[model samples]
Target: MKLSSEQIKQKLKDAGLRVTPQRHAILEAVYTLGNHPSAEQVIDFIRVRYPGIATGTVYNVLDVMVESGLVKRVKTDKDAMRYDAIMNRHHHIYCAESDRIEDYFDEELDELLQAYFRKKKLQDFKIEDIILQIKGNFNDNSE
Candidate 1:
């Protein structure tokens, strides 16, 4: 999802983050990558267009984005931390063999899980959200 400068600014504002030229460029880099990218990947992407951007700034922006619900942190099976740009209610379909992650959306699944959890009603622990990472091998022929 390629985000325009105005869209990026709005997103930053919505997240209550102070927008700066550097932050705008970094966020644009994340959207340009599209696929879930790690901090190093984000830095690499930004450096091509912005050679002067500090590596620490990329990491800091991502941390703030995650905290402010602008982006999400996805941890792979190998414990590699990746950044996801999608914010809607959805899950991830992960391919362990390929280390690939795809967004999964199932309204029925969501309803069922909610019903089950509501029935259980575990004490003292409130459910903020539920994100399931279904792991399997991606069928190469599906394409």
Candidate 2:
């Protein structure tokens, strides 16, 4: 899901954000990393090439990206904030032992949850999006 420089610039423009070198590098780092990375990790990645980028700039760009719907912030059970570039409706599978996060997409699961919540109908409450972060370890069948 890594975006090219041009694609990143186009996304910024579409989101009404002015494209800058820092934003371009930050967005590219998030998408290229694939695995959800915390702000520190993003800074480390970008610092390799753009040593002049400050920590505040990275955080600011990430905040703007989240506000503009270009990226989503994933908070783990440990309260570590990570970034995800995928904007589609999907859940996540988090492995505690390996500290890995994988995307899980199931239309059936989404429909079931929506139906159940609709039936419950909490008074005066509106449902936004459902996030199910299943945490566990993956067993290797080959072993």
Which stretch of 10 consecutive residues in model 1 shows the poorest summed lDDT?
134-143
| TM-score for candidate 2 | 0.91
lDDT of each: 0.88, 0.90
Best by the TM-score measure: 1
lDDT for model 2 comes to: 0.90
lDDT of 2 by residue, 5-92 (tens): 8999999999999989999999999999888899999999999989999999999999999999999999877666899999989999
Residue pairs with colliding backbones in model 2 are none
TM-score of model number 1: 0.92
Clashing pairs in 1: none
Clashes of each: 0, 0
Following a full C-alpha superposition, what root-mean-square deviation does model 1 have from the true structure?
Answer: 2.0
